[model samples]
Target chain A: MSHPTSTTNKTLAHPLNAWYVAGWDYELTRKPLARTIANRPLALFRTEDGRPVALADACWHRLAPLSMGKTLGRDEIQCPYHGITYNSAGRCTSMPAQETINPSATVPSFPIVDRYRFAWVWLGDPEKADPALIPDMHQMSSPEWAGDGETIYAPCNYQLVLDNLMDLTHEEFVHASSIGQEELSASDFKVTHDDRTVTVARWMFDIEAPPFWLKNMRDKFPGFEGRVDRWQIIHFEAPSTIRIDVGVAKAGTGAADGDRSQGVNGYVMNTISPETDKTCHYFWAFMRNYCLDSQLITTQLRNGVHGVFGEDEAMLKAQQEAIDANPDYEFYSLNIDAGGMWVRRLIERMLEAEGRLAATQEPQPARVGA
Target chain B: MAANSSTVWQRGRVVELRDVARDIRRVVIEPESPVRAAPGTHVDIAVVVNGEQDVRSYSVVESDDDGTRLALSVFRTPTSRGGSVFMHGLGEGAEVELTQPLQNFPLRVGAARYIILAGGIGVTAVLGMARVLARLGADYRFVYAGRSREAMAYLDELIDEHGDRIEVHVDAEGTPLDVPSLVGGLGRDTELYMCGPIRLMDAVRRAWQDFGLDLPNLRYETFGNSGWFDPEEFVVRIPRLGLETVVPKDRSMLEALEAAGADPMFDCRKGECGLCEVEVLELTGDIDHRDVFYSQRQQEASAKMCCCVSRVVTPAATGSRERKPVISIELS
Candidate 1:
């Protein structure tokens, strides 16, 4: 193991206490769902609901990806290339032809967990993974009036959004519509950084002032007259989960269902996951808690968020392209860039803490293909 | 037991089945698993007329895979479902089991020019050797003799598959066999593998002696089964374990050992199956060699298969009084 000099080389392979957003809960089912973390392809599907299972993707027989295979009625995955099937724990189930055989014919599988509506994969030291240590999501469970939400996939690194979300000032300049116009008062928001998580809070008012969708009760919504009454709370738990608050009406009141998008309305909560350093998966769900017709709310929320995600796609793609073109380029900063600096520093510190993992995870010599 | 009892595993459909003769069928066991019996190597085949393990061995004639299909020609007998019967009854698209490759008889190695004599289905195993000779561009002559031209299972097949490499001889002219001419002036590195009924093989076997011909080799595969093992009741002492047990004729030496509380490990069961091997502390009987294990010298010492095939000699049966102390037969 060599000493890691910087945080840029850190990956999900490292064993860290930092939070990692595995995937949407729905991604796991009785079937096998394959995902790659830190370039290591893995199959992670729940044999049953409410579980996050992971296993090495390749079969021992022919090195075929079990992820590409399917499940038989025995809760075993049949290798698509051959008829060899393996069970959940990765044991060879049937040889299809032999009545009896030598006893060394099985594949390998991994340990897993299902928690907080997200398929949380243990992207760290599996032996040390204590389910109690996973981040608790009390916010999602509270019976608060919230809007319905949707999920979207982004073709950019998840860290980009972490950086994007942590740096609160990107909204005013990048997003000219909706809540992006909220101005950050010079010193209104206080910032706090902890060893495992970070939080940022500030106040902004007159958010429904212009180009805003709420036209019916624009005057009726609270804090519509003040220039800075909107209190924005931002939280960035590492790996890739960011939460924020955009002060708005309680769910269900005509405000939550206000005809805002084009002519429709909804609320959104976005989650960003790194499909890879070059591609990211985004999931945003609409929290339509108070909506009278929940099904209709779910549909509207999916469509509206999908459209906005389409817009985000165009911008992120361009951003990734520009980054690729200018890989060696650097950026400057000023005092107003406090949010970006804080998040970056937090990442650097956390990565530095995982020095052991990074050191031992050096790449080995490439195997010659037979 | 039913004739079709030895087959253990198979999943491919039969591509074609031809009753090339009254007692022979050319079965094409295609792309299921690979059948790897060499030119003279044999395999145990199980044909399930009902549900039982009645087995018989057959020599593999060919092995090839072209991505499209594989083919095997077997001669099934109406009286014998084990090999000939199974193959004869197998229809196109019918499933069949070809046990793991068994090398009951390996090809005589290091022979350059050779004479291969076949009688009936005995030619099946020798076909592979002929094919190998052709592939390697080696010099070899084949004399394939059977009842008749059309009645021969692969008579035309050998002609179509290997041209100019074989000489077809049938017993249709009401003439005696020409053993002298066939065995004359054979090359130095040449050998003879005569496979057929006992009489033909014995005749071929004696031709070398009669002609006083010094040939490279002469080998044969006989229609061997049933009495390959004889059952008898007796007692054997193990000097190694210092114990004596009842030896039952119906039970194999391996079964006798375990029945009397001795431990053993094994694999295949046929005498050809090399599992229940035991060391001979001492013995007395003509070591009838049916097993595929051990060498000539070992069998000469009366040391061999105690599991399926072996006999014991008593003190009065043998003249020796002062036997080797602590005489025993331990696990092999």
Candidate 2:
């Protein structure tokens, strides 16, 4: 391997075989919504019967963007240009001036499933699009947890977001005013990975809780004033999804041994979808097991995480700009990169299986006529 | 450039060495720190040749998951400056200095399809890439070309691993590789990566152009030492610095200049990065543009040369130690 000093990690392509959230369930409805997942433009909408549908945004007739068109009848979209209509399955339903419809007048219909409050779309092989493979975001809809989240249209590669989530040490610096703490940088962590998942577990015992965690702890255990046991267990699912188990409890309550009854536990659910080579749709939620009925806590937690992640968003954007400037610089990994490395290895495997990955990620411009 | 002026070299020791094929030896080294190498990664090793330390680059043929161990295959070329000979002479437990594995030839993940072509010793470059694709169940074709069956290293292993996806073209069989046929068979979406002799690379490039394939889709890594002309003694003079040095047949111009205390900016000594490039002020002989850093048009213009792997050659000199062609250049 020749490490070029000027290489950028932004050129890594996204894997398409996995399902990515196209939009929140509420975001897709009678009116068609335009979205790009894994570089494939799509028109997302719901049929009159309330079934989620995703179709290639381009119309079959003149390649017009169907997303600009209006919904009509039961489950069809009328192309804004030339009155072409396509059903939810992307089959041309009717032609304005022609009697016989060309059998080939059909757009690609992606397999879309509505689950966990999201419209998940698969842009790769339709046959392999299995809903079971969707990452486990049960916390989003489960009765045991209550929370809210917002979407961040991050202006950086999806992998960068995943790396941010996989390693929490960055929080110490990037979110110094909120969740950042010296214990985070001083603590040792463990990283483990399998074929489809990676887990990074870190624990800080008998340490002062960070401001964000302190507020959450007070919400559960009022007037708590002693050292606490804090933990951040990052779980990564292949392609791009991460669920971070986080919270703090009283120092000597046996929380480390799975008795979380003395702790305030929260799940930071994140799933990123690449919209292009350098941008992504970051969908994240902060679910808490202790406050299952309080709407106030849900909004407050969402707003707090939002602010913490805003810091990350700024850093990610700056990192991306630096990468763009030095297009040939390669990244140097530290000891903390174990979990992120596994994530990249898994992604590289998926890309290789799709025959889209080379051993080296050299950013070659799209050649003319290619 | 100043940040990269100083390189950090770590101590390593040879753990094992064995002949894998004709003139090809596989040497395994354990560096002080664990090394994880991606496919198409190579390392720069400081080899002591004739009591003087010189740097040489070699691709990592394989590595364990933990990266504590790495294996590199070297072909002993009688004309090689010194890297291969020094490596061939090393015994188990021999101490050496090497840089961390670096990747200049990374395989971009996520293409529609791929065709991996390797020629003779060039197999060392793409072997890891082939294994990765095979492990991932990617849609790919592996083509290996060699002068004879015995000369092809890891032939049996590749055939066993890739099964029918492996295609071998042994020149001894009197049926050489057909570049046009190969290029014609490629799908428009297929990316082809090749590493081989200069003749083979030239044929492939010509065929790719004739077929009107995508230029960027045809990626390749060239041997820095294999040029249009054989190695010969050359004289390099920098008028601005009042420096003149003789680059012997066994030494590269970059190394010779550095030995003479001429500070030059260089990275990826394999002629991939144009950093070590110098402006051709004057030439008393023809320049062999061996580096892949320049385009064919740039090489033909005769305005510069990558001193790391390129040199000046006299038209009438062949195996003549007395012939020293002088080339005046300005460090860029």
Candidate 3:
């Protein structure tokens, strides 16, 4: 195994102004919850009115983690070490031993908005916190859809997870027994990109259904076994949100031509937030539009997805260790890395723009619309 | 006499205009100066229509904390009487006069919980309330009902920002919202705030009353254009002014009176204000009292009506040859 220092030096820096899924919304309640984003410790909690707020975990006075402190009243957080209280905006409101709060007694507060059952925090300029920039995860919230998911902490860089999601050919090798099928590996795929999004789509026609799909679809369609058309459409938003729409239908059902109802459709929402250079927070939700009220299907799909992602996590962590051991080795890109590469390019462009703007010391142009 | 001091007129530039939903355009205005806007507040904007300054009130959908910019989602209804048409016609960079943010439906803080009921374009009014509640960490449920998801303004953004706290009911999806069940399911201490079409508000109000909920807990704002009775041609007799005019189905009594050169005192044409109230001398029909300004007792008395929105609906007499529901009223 390589020394820890070798891995520490290889940690990647993420863009500061982009939104990152900090954690599930239900995780941050009355109690102060602590999480790390881009290597910065953050404390998340709700005020008296139930609004979620995110602030730097460190107290400005004694450098104690605010998450260790108890929330006072509805909007104030009292440092556990010194009993100093800070308001929801991170301004020091009171000190037990001081008559007045110091002029510089404040902590950085990040803009947070709850969406798709996740609290997204903007770690950049508050003025630039445009809620519209948040990726549209409508399937998770719409009543037309239903599913369950679990958040797993992976001891690997988020980029590795992105690569894993962008390329599903590994499924045939990694998850052979569950969701994997030979058709996925044999099928050709295409990658497309716009100004802010990248999409990788694959279709396998007249192929046998995978074991997982066959198990889930048997009761819904109990006819004799037959060939089916399968598809996997992966959409990567700027930064770290990926949604994979995968399903299967009877052959020649026109499932690829915007008519998804012809097939059993399901969505895999994978949102990654970098906790540090070597570790990330992985938030995943699996949902389906059909059988929405069926708890059996929900549980079965949840477990299936959880197990599938566990396989990816094991591979990604092992890959990270390998990269750490061979620090001088440069990685080569493959045909399937197009989507992940596009995502990285977009992040680089955003970081470069932010750096240029900072160097010029120019204020962001006033935004007229959301 | 001093000019009307109640309205603090301000100039604003239309910086952005884009469709948020079918027939619903999101108008973003940058005020000449900053203006503070409380939750559930609205602003009155004035526009030129047919060479006349026509003013209409629009709920503030979103605003910066400092109120440097204001966003109003305007829905151009099929029956819009020039105001929404003019607003929809405006392009980016258009300048208009607007009143400072006015709080008619101010959100009551400190409630144990909140229930926001919105219908169609009425989502614009309740949006800020939801934002404030989310920020305060207050417990609230937002229910938005519309004919269809595509026709609902700010549906995507609201769902994105609110998560599961929002419940959307689209009639086209056959998932019509049951207002009674929703109202009855509310906690005893939950406060309800609603804004929408007249019919929806009326239905909710009826359901709320049936549930025997506290009257104080129920709050609502109307667009002033909705009425219980289908609008029909009516004859208005003004004895004091010695003028008679035919109020068309599309026109209000106030508009007809004003067009006939009679200056009638009026404000808030949406029936919330009694400024345009006129004593009914001889009502030859039953009155359709639509304004929120009067109590049930006053409406039952049938002594006066808000000429701006409330109208007379004549009932057919038993065994009468002419069974038409024509409304005829003599104004005092």
Candidate 4:
């Protein structure tokens, strides 16, 4: 018999208290862009002075979408249905029907911060919104790091994408031709977590570089060829952000000991924002410490990561479909799920703090015979 | 969804066992796999109580960064439902069934300032969290209270590690905790995380409300075994299951039902989760609710009870002395 209860559901509710990236800094311009985060629709735009702002997408008058309307003076947006105009704070400044605006004729203006080349919006209580709580994605804006990235409209829950990045063993099966190597599953990893972060670090010694790493190595050192030491250190910050530090060094270098002078290092920056229960807006970038001035290398690496992540997109879509089909079945986890489990636990805590947790228990590791 | 992998009960060996306080035992368990435990992590042990296997949860006191080893201290409650008694009897090399480290009371990072309060045995649940905040160089204070100095576990160790950041209060020393002043003095940005006896938690809760502090800023973990009234033997009759059993003072209603072959759904087993709640069709005695899951209004209604930790307490002189307190429930 199948039993469906709140405690066994696979889909998790999002935490509104945390910050989720709405779009790239360039995407939010004078024109308003409609985006949803944590199930709340927001109209994102920039002020004339180049400061980002996020307001409720629904107009206070007649509930018309404000994003469909055009910008008026400075930072004001006009309602598409009527001529009502709202300022950056979502307060109605002009009403065509009357001289005096209604005191309650105001939409919610969320607190937004433009940092690390992304516009992050807080969809919860404005009083508790703190910019310091934004996940650290320093590589995106650092002058020492150079790269570019794109957005993936993933057809899966944000947690699925988080699980995919927390464990890289699946790369051996999903992206075998690009970054996969048999040594990945064979290597032992150490998983550590604090209140807000979970880290999984793995290193492979004296192994042949995967095709993706080999190509990147040759870009920095034209004729680089040899067995190399590879490392994948994944750091996950609460809600939905993961930054992976990856690279390969010459076999005998002391890369594992914090000396990576003879290595080519790159960081895969990812922050996913939930648009709804079954969809997410995935913003990612591929940044590298080396080749800071090489536009050719930057474009190549971006495209390379794009191709690699496409495979994950397909797999995650299929996984979500399977989950929907078998709503009575719960996911089973293995040793590889240690990091992902911590990520889920952290998100669960956030949801509980927001009074949204409904007894949903993420699957634990499979039971072994006693 | 069906219950699949909420927990993986595995066999673990009691590698070390020692007395940490006057009535507390510190146990070290070595599982087959490494368990990386963060702050507020706990483990569920399948202990044999009343000759039947039952699950009990205890907060982790300490753990290695690599999770190769885990330590927990259990208070030898004189009024326990036998979980603590079974734990106190465990010797080195004993095999026990245990779940991996599970966290429900996670410490939210990035708070402006933190104040961690522990009352008596509640210290076990908040010790790791205080340590993490201290290590991060964050602004925090640790307030620990016990009935006496000798009964406090890890008192010297905590003082040595945290130094001036630690504050000690002993009721026997006439330094009882002042919840009203503590709650009233909290700053607007301070987050208070506490774990302790129900009365202590209740006092803090009432004081926090009176001061009109942010509700979300006050987080706590319930000592599941502690409640408002002393446990008494009662009769639980489930009509649909056609089961009737006597819940002894040393056992919980959920344990009694499971022992009678009536499987009941439960998670956390600490009464925080409402999965094990059953509708109360009728009652012949007052319900001693020990769960934080329900609100004051809901508990006052007496329409439902959490089977994991709640029970009925009959008046001493009501009806015949031989007649036990009975509660009829509807279980789906």
Candidate 5:
């Protein structure tokens, strides 16, 4: 039995605004790439000038994905199931099965852009996109050369990871045998958090680094005994996402200019995306002031990050299982964990900004700058 | 005269082809428009090689709901020059001109028992009829016969789903088809329809007649001359309209008439696609029910020619009048 309500309810909100990474450029060079955005399957493609476009995955005629289709002599995606070809704007271009080519037909297409070397898609309203207002990335481009960048998909919400990354103290326990040690903030180093994102930065000066296997500084310097310089930066962007940056600044002579350059400063920015309420994906890009060739800078950084991600996945999975077992495990919030509270506030504010926030929940507008 | 009009739409190139069996093929057609054909409606598929409309009529073996796409299984006739040449050249998505559907073969509408018989690739037509029958929730018996099992297309689909109601006949060494025994098996209420090479149809007709049984309406579709498209039957002239033309006797009466000059409006062509069919300005013909598409009443009142199938049966112009014709011209 169907209710005789208004018929306009068929179309719903497309989770847009903020930045949504569509896919890698190399993979979908000539063919349409098939993926799901905002809980619906979509095909991402390009026009001749490299402008990216996304459309509903299935063809309106046969319900076959446009991605499985081929481009006709004219610019468009054709369903492989049937030869029904559609244009960039999701309009049917022609029915090859017919005797004549139809010039007027179409399908629904999503708005997309390629900026900062990433294919960012607008899953919601096209009218709201402002190119001038893209996500901020201060540590990218040319030399102070950024390290290799890589990506990984997580089977959980992008929010949870943002919260986890913001609460970096977890690495001490979660990554105990890997990147973190329990001695991180034992003596009240410092912590900062408000709205937007949390930053736990402090001068780790003149202190022996964690272990004998932590990359370049596995062993401590006699002159710089228990000493090194490091600073951490992290950002949480909307709809559903998080960004984490960790950098190391040098205190002495520099190899970069041979004229006492400012030592080594490294940065790792994590871009997390919420594919669904329970699934998330992250794109991690690394940058370093120290010199490294394209091969080592590219290949090794990806491998190393992937290895670290493998560990995080196992821990996240187990943690999710525990949460599933107990629906009502109320836990108290701590001052040091201020980053997590802000991440939730950001999600709520983004939802509200898009008119998607629930009426039952009061709007907790997170204070912007931290 | 509102159903059968003879007009030829576009024809396409033979693009893709594959041999599904020893002589059967899966021919995919890339049409020029959305065909939205029902399952049972047959399309006139004309393939030209070396430049001739070597036309072969085949029922759509399968059709999508919108009638935009269709699939047919044609059993290649190796002996016929036009037939063999056309079949061997078919490739995937090749262009083929198809007339809008001319649905001449129709099952008795409503919930009636349908008995379908296919002789060989005669199965193509009934195969479509069976599908519509299933969709309509009507009970049916599909009697598929061939020289042997290999000749039958999609034999497995029938065997898998309708095995209980299906009957197979072949001129085998050991087992034979008990025709009388098979006919003797049906109850009086069943509607029987048979399509195949002449012999099998003859056998079924004889058997059913011998029993003096209540037979279902028996029908058949035979190939017509290319004149099916010629509308000129005689030198026609719209006196006041200044229209004078010769309408061929062989083409659809309306087309020939229209061409020579009398434009008779029609509607459907199975005596159904009647874009040019119209009321009687003058009527004549056996009014053959060869077109199973229309009802008895519609056919009667309309005095329809289904110009695709109907022809003029002139009275005085019968064989003798044109012997000495030297009539002068005087027009409006």
Candidate 6:
């Protein structure tokens, strides 16, 4: 199979017509919050009625960032530079100094919805926005699961982060002190895909528990001295949602089958939204089914995952810097990049299809003589 | 009568087909060209059934903006005449004709709250509405009912996606829907939309009226050719074509015209698309407005009617009546 060389290019465009996590629900308050996605600045906040809204951060008049402004009434955002107040739909509602406000005076508003404790924004045509495409991360909010989440700004390209998550072999060397184990790199794995999703699954039979798992599972299972069944299932939902299901169970407990109750199950939701060419917003949560009400386990898992991500951040940032220094060099893909490569191909196909549509939809030029 | 002049037909290829439920097949198609469709809209698919071109409407389960792909979940009922069976018999890579998405049962955004009622395969019609409402952060509840869990399409997916917001009632499971209680418990300023079998819709309509809810807020769309009046044979006169045809109780006006060799441009025989509409020059009886395409005022005026679904009803035969309702119309 032939691979597109452009996939390795650093200037690849991010797919826009898809839902991306802007921030957690708790992060947005009455105050405007600024975030950059796909190199576009966005101002996000909730109205008095608790409806989340996102708009272009730049004012339509003087190009001042709206995140620096204050909210007026129940749903209008007032620009600090000119006192131009806009409603939740991004239409300019009032202008303090002008006698007649221009009807065209408005900023681009994005389609936003709150679900699973996260505010998701559609950075595409509002008319075509469909919430069904949003990845199912309900486990984070379900009563049967307990977990904590965190958002970190990584100084690296979003694709680098995706690549890192898609291939967990690095964990053996990078996260050896915590959740890493040799079985992760040594075990055989399989890659599968449907029309809209890609999954990478790996199972290590009768393997020793890693440090983090041992620390958490020792209390739950006191007789956990022998080998156990461990599995890692990573799912990539287009365009940029990654969920990793990692857990272990007693030897020969049928955990590999549909019976997950025989094992301890936890989910790692890693949602990547591009901030710019060299930065991204990483919203992540760790949910476990075994300890639904244990605050201690939640905190421990949160800190442990946070530290593990920090190690990835350091490595990715350094990698980005090196790639920047050698801008003309093209990166090569390995056998383990199958999952990440599939995601890249899907994004490219969508982008190409959109481009073709726009080309055809462009107004035809009038006949020269007619 | 002249055929509908505004219908735009496009070619689509069936790419995938899988049974999601006992008799429900999730059909995914790739159109010849990309077409954009909003949530709560449907497209008319044209299939050759028994050596004749037949058109039927199916709700769009999902579609992208570029329209590169469209997905529809269709259920084959035992009472189905031929449309559902013809669609089910289609294999992968079979190219068929379809019209652009048409919106007859549109979701009215900005309501204080939304209540969606879906019965059996009718869930396909309101599934997109729920998705859009969820994305808008609007308060909404989805109540879906069917004979059994095994016969319901998208039940598992809907529950997985919407969680507590969805309430599923399976009759075989002893969970029957309480229409009165459900309608009575609705909050003020809420709008209710339903799409289902005639019985379910009629029950909801009656309960809604009993509860004193705003009649305009209770919107609905029927499956196919379903109406309150029992099917009866009638005669249609086309002044321009100088043709008169007898529409049998089992056939629609459009079908009768086609059988009489009078071409009628039409799409979405389900009565959603305004194509195949005809101007009513004279009417000798009351009209049964089965189609949801026309407003109440338009239906009352009796000026025009969608030939695909709407029909005329003569005054009840009284004192040995032998003549049927005669509707003189011209193709619009």
Best by the TM-score measure:
6
| lDDT, candidate 4, A1-370, per-residue tens | 2323322446677888889999999999999898888788888888777778888899986899999987887668888998788877676767773323443367878878889999998887553566878999999999999999999999999889999999999999999999998999999999999999999999999999988999988988889999899999999999899999999998989999999988899999999999999999999999999989999999999999999999999999999998777665656678998999888878888877776775555553233341
Per-prediction backbone clash count: 34, 26, 10, 1, 76, 2
Ranking by TM-score: 6, 4, 2, 3, 5, 1
Off by over 4 Å in 5: A1-15, A97-105, A138-143, A187-203, A211-214, A217-226, A239-243, A249-262, A292-294, A359-370, B1-332
Model 3 interface CAPRI class: incorrect
Instruction: Judge candidate 6 at residue B57 and give its lDDT.
Output: 87
Q: lDDT of candidate 6 vs native? A: 0.80
TM-score per candidate, chains pooled: 0.45, 0.52, 0.51, 0.53, 0.47, 0.55
> Per-residue CA lDDT of candidate 6, range A265-352, in tens?
8899898998886899999999998867788888988998999999998999899998778655556678877887777667666666
Higher lDDT: candidate 2 or 5? Answer: 2
lDDT of 6 by residue, B1-332 (tens): 11234456789999999999999999988988667667777888986767898788898888976778889988997988688998899899999898777675767554567898899988888998888887767789999999999999988899998888999999999999989999999854577889888898999999988998755567685334466677677899998999999988888899999998889889767665567889999887767877756767788887888898888776655422377888998985
Off-target runs (Cα >4 Å) in candidate 6 are: A1-7, A356-370, B1-332
Model 6 chain A TM-score equals 0.92
RMSD of each candidate relative to the true structure: 25.4, 18.9, 20.8, 16.7, 23.5, 15.5
Clashing pairs in 3: A49-B136, A49-B137, A49-B138, A50-B136, A50-B137, A50-B138, A51-B134, A51-B136, A51-B137, B224-B270
Chain A superposition TM-score per model: 0.74, 0.95, 0.91, 0.95, 0.79, 0.92
* Ranking according to lDDT, highest score first: 4, 2, 6, 3, 1, 5
Rate residue B82 of model 6 by lDDT.
80
Question: Of the candidates numbered 4 and 6, which has the greater lDDT value?
Answer: 4
DockQ of each model vs. true complex: 0.01, 0.01, 0.01, 0.01, 0.01, 0.03
lDDT of 1 by residue, A1-370 (tens): 2533223332223335433555667777767777775445777666532335566788776788888888765246778787777656555656554333222355545435555566655555433344555554534444554444555566666655665666666556565564355455342666787765677766543344334434312323433332223445676665456666544442232432332221222223555656666776675665433443456545654665566556667777777777667544434455654665566655555556665444533343232241
Q: Model 3: how far is A98 from its true place, Å?
A: 3.8
Each model's lDDT comes to 0.57, 0.84, 0.79, 0.85, 0.56, 0.80
* Candidate 6 displacement at residue B315 in angstroms: 60
The candidate 2 chain A region of ten consecutive residues with least summed lDDT is A2-11
lDDT for model 2, on a 0 to 1 scale? Answer: 0.84
lDDT of 4 at B274: 72
RMSD of 2: 18.9
